[model samples]
Target chain A: MKKTLVIDGAPQNCALTRTPGGMRLLVGERSFDCALETLGDGRYRLRAGDVRRDVLLAQQGDQLWVHVDGRTHAIQRINPLDALAAGGRGGADSTLAPMPGTILTVQVKPGDAVKSGQILLTMESMKLEVTITAPHDGEIAEVLCAPGQSVPVKATLVRFAAKAEATP
Target chain B: MTPQPIRRLLVANRGEIAARILRTARARGITTAIVRHPDEEGGLAPRLADDCLTINGPTPVAAYLDVAEIVRVAREWGADAVHPGYGFLSENARLARALAEAGIRFVGPTPEVIELMGDKIRARNFVVERGFPVAPSAIEADDPATFAQRALAVGLPILIKPAAGGGGKGMRIVRDASVLEAELATARREGERYFGDGRLFVERYVERPRHIEVQVFGDSHGKVVHFGERECSVQRRFQKIIEETPSPVLTPEKRGAICEAAAGIARAAAYVGAGTVEFIYGAGGEFYFLEMNTRLQVEHPVTEMVTGFDLVAEQLRVCEGEALGYEQSEITAQGHSIELRICAEDPSQGFVPATGTIHLLREASGPGVRVDSGVHEGQRVGSDFDPLLSKVIVHGRDRREAIARARQALRDTALLGITTNTAYLDRVLAHPLFAAGDYSTAFLDEQAAALSGKDEPLPLDLLLAAAALSDRQMVDAATSVPAIYAAMGAWRN
Candidate 1:
C-alpha cells in the first residue's frame, strides 16, 4: 500500500510492503523494518530500528494524532492520486494559514526552492509575530498571498510542487 | 469594631485561584459562592463552588470587573465575606471599599493599604519614608522634555514602569539615554492602553537580578508573620514562568533579613490577610524593594508546599479576627518545592496564545505532585482571558529531587487538542544550566536560541506508519457498524 504523509502540511511519499519477517516501510527516501502491535485504547507499540515506543494514537478527520514521550505529532495521509489531481495542494505539500493574521513579509516567489524549516513569510496577529516555514524540502508551486493581505485561518498560503524526485 | 465570623464567602475571581479558595473555604465549613462570567460558565471554578452566581454585563470582562454587580451578588447570596482571588480586581481598592460599604469582610487587606501598595511610586516612597531600602527612582515629571534629565539622574539602563501596573505590562528598559524619549512615550502609551494610569516611574534597572518575594500575613489584631522567600527569576518578557521556594541564591542571614523586612512593612501598614513583598536581589548581596503585591500571589502553592499551611484558610481566619496561631519561630520550611505554569501557548511558535477546545486532559497525580488546573475536557478556551490553563507543583526532599519529580509528572500529564508549553517546559527542566540552579532572570532571553529552536527531526517513516495505521483503525471501526450503512443508504436522496 502507498500513500503520502503530510506532517505540518509537508508531504512525503510513503509505501508499506509486507515481508515474511515484518513490514518494510518507506517514507520519502528512508526505509525501515517495522512491526506494530495493538496495545488497546488507541495505543500501538511500534518497533523500528533500536527504538520500541508505545505510541498513543487517535484519528480526527484527515489528521492523525500520535503522542510519544510527552510530545504529540499530527500528520495527515493522502492518496497519491489525490496529490496528482490537486497538484500537491490537496495533500501534505500545502501550507495552510495556522492563524488569522495579516501577512507582514513574503520571502518566497513561485518556483523558488525552499528547504524544510526555512521561513517562507511572517504573519502578525494580536501583536505577536509568527514565521511561516516550509515543512519539507521542495520547490514552491504557487504563492497565493502577498504582504499586507489579510487571511483567515486554514487559508492556503503556499503550495509545494509534487515531488517527481521520489520513486516507488 | 468587633469582627464577625464569616458564614458564607464569595470569591470574586475566576479560574484556578477561585477553585483553590473554594477548597479551603469548604474545608473550614464555610459555604462558598463564586462569580462567573458568561464566557466562563463551565469553567472549573464555578463547577466547584456551592453557589455559582452569574454576573451578566455587555461583555465578559465588563461583567467580571463590575464592582457594584459583584457586591450586590455577594449581598443577595448572603455572603458575609468576599475573597478577591488574584487577578481581576484582586488589588483593586474600589472593590475592597465597596465590600466594606456593603458590610462584608474582604479577605485581603484594607482599601487604604491596597491603594498604598498598589501604586509603584507611592509604595516606593512609603517604604523609603519608613527607612526601607529602595532603588533610586524618579517619578515622571510634568514636562515631557525634562523626563530625560530626571531619568539620567537616576542613572542609565533605567526601567520605565507604570505606576499602577502589577504585571510586566507597559514596562520598558532603556539601556542608554539616546532613545529615552522614544521609549518613554511607548511605555506611557502602553500604560494608558493596558492600565488606565499613564503615570510612569523610572528606576535604575538591575541587570540579571533575582526576583525574590516574601509572603506575609497579618490580622485585624495587628500581628504580622512572614514565610520564607520564593525565587521567581525564571522569567520571559518580564513575567515569571517558573518559581521555587527558599530562593536558591539567598543565604541564611539574608533570608532572615528579607523576611523580617516584609513582616515589618505589613505590620506598619496594618495589613490584613495574605500579601507578598517583592525584592530585586543583586549579585553583590544588595537587595531593594521592588513592589508589594497586596493580594495572594499566583505562585503561593510553592510556599504552601514547603510550609504545610493553607494560605487561603489563614486569610479566612484572619478575616474572622483571629490572631495567627503561630509565630515566626514556629514557621519552618520542610523541603524544596517548584511550580511550573502550564499555559495554553505554542512555545515552538514564539509562545503565541493558542485557542481551542480542550479535547482531552490527563492531569499528573502522584506523591508530592499537585495540579491546580482551570480547564477540563470539552471546555472552549477562547483568547479573551489569561492563557494559564493549569499549574504543576511538585515537592521533594531537595531541589534535585523536585526537578526530577516535576519532569516525570509533566511527562505523565497530557493536554491534547491545543498546543501548549508542556514539551518546552520539559526541555527547560532537562537543560543543564537550569538543573544546576546557576541561572539568572536572563536565563530565557540568553538561552532563547537553544531553548526555542527546533528539536531533532522526527523520523518520517514513523509518522507515516502512525498516520496509516490510525486511519485504517478508524475505517475498521466505522465499517463494523452496520446500522451506519443503512442510515447512509436512507440519507441518499
Candidate 2:
C-alpha cells in the first residue's frame, strides 16, 4: 500500500509491501526493511534494520498522532490536491496560523468590526480546537481562509485594518 | 505519655505525592486510604490506595481542599491519622485543628505552628524575632500608598506579594518606584481573587538568588534533625522545575549554617513532624528565611536520594511520638542528586497545560535513575489539578555524573500522548550554563530563548518514519493472518 503523510506540514510519500520476512518499506530518498509488531493497546515495536523503537499510536479522525520516544507529532495523510489547496493565507496586518492545520471555522468576514481578543476564527490542530483571536480592535480588511481549508504555518487567515478614531 | 499508633493513614491529597505517601505507608503494613476529587475517579492515587473515597465539589482540586469533608471522612473511615500530602490542606491550620478535634493525628505540625508559619508576614517576623535573618519586608492592609513609601526604603527591585499565600501567586517584582503602586494594586487584586485575602506585603526582591532549603524533621519528643539541603534555583514563574542537592553555590560552612538555622527555627516553633525551611542564599553567601513548608515537599526525593532517609517514614514515626534515634552527626549525605519535574505542559506554547490520555509511557530505569510518577499508560490526565505528571530523579558520585545520568534518564523517559515538557527539560539539562552549574533562579527566564528555540534542525525523515511506524492501521497490516489466508476466502485448511 502507498500513502502520503503530511509531517510537520510537508508531504512524504511512503510505500509498504508485505513480505513473509517482515515488510519492505520505501520512504522519500530511502528504503528499508522493517518489521512492525503490536504490543497491544495502541503501542508498536518497530524494528528498522538494527534500529528498534517503541511507538504509541492514536488516531484522531484522519490525523495520526504518533509518539516516538518522548516527542509527539500529529501527522495527517493528505492527497496531492489537498496539499496544493493548503496555501499560505497570512499577510501583514492579518492573523497568521500558529500551527499548520485545517481551518474549522471562520467567524469573521470582510469589513466586519472586531474587538481586541475577539474570536475571529478557529483552527483544529492535533485534534485540539485553537481559537484565533483579534490582536487588537480593528475592522476586518479581508477574510483570507474558509472552513475546511487546510493552511500551512504562517498562513494568514484574516486581514485587519485599524479602526478610524472618532473626531470630537 | 505514649502516642496513638497510626493503624490507618488517610492521605488528603492527590497525584504523585499521594502515591508516594502510600508507598511508605503500605511498607509499614499500614492500611491506606486516599481522598480524590470525583474528576480523578480512577486516577493513579485512588488506584494505588487500599481505599478510594470520592469528594465532590465545584472543581476537582477543591474537593481535596474541603477541610470539613476531609475531616469528616477521616473520622467516619476510622483513620488513625490524616496525611495532607503537600499542597491542598497541607499547611492549613484549620484542617490540623479539625483533625485534632476529630481525634485523628495530623501527620504534620500542630495547628498553632501551621497557623504561625502559614502566614508569610507572620512567619518572617517570627523567624526574624528569633534571630533568623529575613528579607526586608513591609506589611500593609489595602494601603498601597503606605506600602509604596515603606518600599522605597526597602529599596527598588522589591516583590509585592500577598501576605497570606504561597506558590508565588499574587507576587510581582517592582524594578521602578513609579510602577510600584500599580503593581501593588495588581498584586492585591490577584491575592483577593485567588486567596480571598487582600492583605499585601512588599519585600526586597533577592535578584538571582539560589533557593536552598533544608529539610528539618521534629519528633514529638523534642528532637529535630536537618537533612542537608536541596538547591531549587531552576524555576519558572516561581515554580521550581529542577532541584538538586549540595547547591552548586553553598560552601561547607554556609551549608552547616543554613542547616543549623533550619533546625533552630523548627525547634523554636516546637514544630513536630516534617517541615522544610526555605532560604534565599545571596551571591555573597548571605541567606534569608523564605518560609517553612510545614509538610512534605514536592522535591523531597532529592534529599531522600542523598540522605538515604525516607522522610515520609520519619513523619509517621514523629507523629507516633517516636524519638529520632540518630543524631545530626550520624546523618550522612552521599552522592549527588538532581530532579526534573515532568509537567503536562506544552513548552512551545508558553507552557500551557495540556490534558488528554497518556497513550504510552516508558519510565527510565537502570542504575542511578528513579522515576516517581503518579500517571500511567492509558490514564486520562484532566486539567483539573496540578499539571505535574511525574518526577525524574538521578543520583551519582558527583554533580557532573548526576547531570549526565539525569540527561540519560530524561532521554530514555517517554510519555507519548498529551504534550509534555520532557523535551524542554532535556534542552535545559544540556545547556552549557546548566552543565557548568552556574545557573540561578533566573536561569529559565534568562535562557528562555535558547532553551525553547529549535536550536537544531528538525529531523523530518526520522519523524516521518516513526510516524509511519506508529500508524494505527499498521497494526492490521502487521497482524493480518498472512495475505494467502485472505486470498483463500475462509478456507478450512
Best by TM-score: 1
Query: How many residue-pair clashes does candidate 2 contain?
Result: 3
Write model 2 residue lDDT over B308-404, tens digit each, in one string: 9999999998888888889999999999999999998777786656666776677899898988889888888765567898999999999999998
- lDDT for every model? 0.81, 0.81
Question: What is the C-alpha DockQ of each candidate?
Answer: 0.13, 0.15
Give me candidate 2's interface root-mean-square deviation.
7.5
TM-score of chain A of each: 0.53, 0.50
- Pairs of residues clashing in candidate 2: A89-A156, A90-A155, A90-A156
- After superposition, the stretches of candidate 2 with alpha carbons farther than 4 Å from their true spots are A1-133, A139-168, B142-144, B469-493
Candidates in order, TM-scores: namely 0.83, 0.83
Q: What TM value does chain B of candidate 1 have?
A: 0.93
